[model samples]
Target: MPILKFPPIESADEQGIVAIGGDLHVESLKLAYKKGIFPWPISEDYPLAWFSPNPRAVFDLNNIHIPKKLKKFINNCSYKITYNTAFERVIRKARDIHQNSIHGTWITEEVIAAYIQLFREGHAYSVEVWEDKELIGGLYGVCFGKFINGESMFHIKDNASKIALLSILSNIKRADIKYFDTQMITNVTGSLGAIEIERPDFLDYVANTTAEKEINFQNFSLHLDFDL
Candidate 1:
C-alpha cells in the first residue's frame, strides 16, 4: 500500500481540485475524507486528483425524496439487501457498471485496492441489492463519522440501485449518520432528492463530528414511508 498526501482543501482551485498524484492508501484516503476532499482521477493515464467541490451536492436527511415509481418498485419487488456483506464485490460491480455507462472508469485497480483496504479497516461500507440470489445492483463510498461520501452506484435491473439507496437512508438512525453526500449532483441524484450546499456548510457537517456505526449491519432494515 502506498501513502497518500494532499494539499489543504482551501487550496483547491475554482474547479474543486485540491491536489494530485497520491495513491489511495487507507491513511491518506481517511485523511482526505476528514478534510472534505475526494479523488476523481482525470484519466487512467493521470495521477489522482482530489476535489471538494463548492456548492457540494448532498441529501438533506430531512428533505430526501423517493420518486413514486421507485417507491412502487420497492413495494412491489421481491429482493434482498445487505450492507457491508460484500464490499469488494459491490465496489467492483459499481465500477464496471459505471464503465459501461460512460467512456471510462475511475475505479482503477489502484482505487479498488485502496477502498477494499478501507473496508477492511471499517472506514468504508457498501450496500448490495440482490434478485433471485444474484447480485443486481450496489453502491459503495467512504464513511467519515456522521457523514458519508457516496462514490458510485450501478444497477442491472430497474430500480436496483434505488433500492440500495433506500436501504441506506432508512437505516440512518441506526447508523447514526447525519448527512448523505452524493459528492456531485446529477439528474439521477437530483431526482432522488439531493441538493447543492456551500462547501463550508459541508465542512461544518463532517468536521470533527463523529458517528461510527452503532448498530450491526445485519440488524439494519429499510422501513420505508417513501414520503408519498
Candidate 2:
C-alpha cells in the first residue's frame, strides 16, 4: 500500500476528515500527527481514515479533575504507574478492551506496528500500571507540541486506568504543558475532566498554546511524586 497525503482540512467546522486511504507506516504516522491528523478505521480491512475532528475533546493540563473518591484510591492504592515501561503490552490491552466495547476498535495490527515504531522514536508513549509486579492497566497516545492526544485506555483492575490517567496528567502539569487532547468525548473521558469545545475554540487553544513552545518528547518523565 502507498502512503497517503491529506488535503488541507476544509474548515474547523468540517470535522477535518483529511483523507480516507493509507498505510499505517511509521513515517506516515509521524507526518500525520505533526499536522494534527490521526488514523481511525472501523476494522483492519477498511481503508484507513484520517481525522482532525472539529470540536476536539480536550483537558486542560492543570485542570484534570481527580474526583475525591479516585484521589482516595490513589492515596491508598499500592499500584504504581510508570511511563514507556511496557508500550507493546499497553497497546495490546487497549486493543483487547476496545474490541469489547460497542464502538469496537480501529487499532489494527498495522496501527499497532506504526505506534510501536513511534514509541521507539520517542513520539508515542504509554502509561503503565503495576500491582505487585503484575500489569493491571495503562493508556497510550502521541505527543506533539504542547498537546498529548490521548488515544485509548484500559484496565484489568478497578480504577487502574484512572490511576494511569491521573499520573499522566500530573506529569503534564508538572512539565507545564498546556493542552491534552482527548480526540473525542465519551462519558468515561468526561468524568475524568475532558470537555468538548467548538472547533474554532479548540484550534484557538491549540494555536495559542503551541505557538511559543515545542513539546520535547525526549524530556518527558513520569517519575515525579504525584500529590493527588
Candidate 3:
C-alpha cells in the first residue's frame, strides 16, 4: 500500500479534524500517531476521522493530582496490575463500555483490529488491573519513544480504571517521561491534573521529547506499594 499523507495541523478547522475517510492500515495508523494525529470514527454512516485537537489535554507527569479518596483507595485496594498482558482485552472492554453509553463509541471492529496489530508490533501498550483471576479495569495507548498517547480506559469495578492509570503513571514516571497525553480532557481527567495546551506547543513537545529509545513495557509493571 502507498503511504498516507496528512495535511498540516494548522489546516484543521475549529473542530481539529485534519482529515476524514482513511483506512486503518497499521502504517497509516503509525504515520498519523507520529504526526500527533489520531483516528476517531464519527459513526457507521461517516468515514473515519482524524484529529489533532487544539488545546490538547495532557498530564504533567510531575504534578498528577490524586484525590484524597482515590489515594486512599489505591493504598487499600488489593488489585494487581500488569503491563502489556491483555491489551486486546482492555481495548475491547473499553469499546463495550463506550458502546453501551448514550454517546456511543468510535471503537469499531476496524479500530480494534488496527490497535491489536499495533500492540503486536510493540508500538502500543496496556496496563491491566486484576483481582486474583478476574480482570476489572485497564487502559491502552500508542507510544512513541517517551511520549504516550493514552487512547482509552475502562473499569468494571469502582475506581478500577483510575487505579490502572495511577499504576501506569507511576511506572512511566520512573522511566522519566514528562507528559501523558489524554487527548481530550474530561471532568475525570481534569480532576486528576490534566491541563490543556495549544496544538503548536503540543506538537513541538512531541517532536522534541520523542527519542529512538524505546520503553520496555514488558519489563514495566506496577508495584502494589505506590507513592501518589
The most accurate candidate by lDDT is: 3
The CA lDDT at 217 in model 1 is 58
lDDT of 2 by residue, 124-185 (tens): 88989998989999999987556577788899899988778777777777677767888897
Candidate 3 residue-wise lDDT, 17-66, digit = tens = 99988688999988888888988888888988899999899988889998
Off by over 4 Å in 2: 1-4, 11-16, 204-228
Per-prediction TM-score? 0.91, 0.86, 0.96
Each model's total of backbone clashes: 0, 0, 0
What are the lDDT figures for the candidates, one per model? 0.78, 0.76, 0.86
Model 1 off-target regions past 4 Å? Answer: 1-5, 173-176, 211-216, 222-228
Winner on TM-score between 1 and 3 is 3
- The ten-residue window of minimal lDDT in model 1 covers 208-217
Q: Which pairs of residues collide in candidate 1?
A: none
For model 3, where is the 10-residue window of minimal lDDT?
219-228
Candidate 3, residue 203: lDDT: 91
lDDT of the structure predicted as candidate 2? 0.76
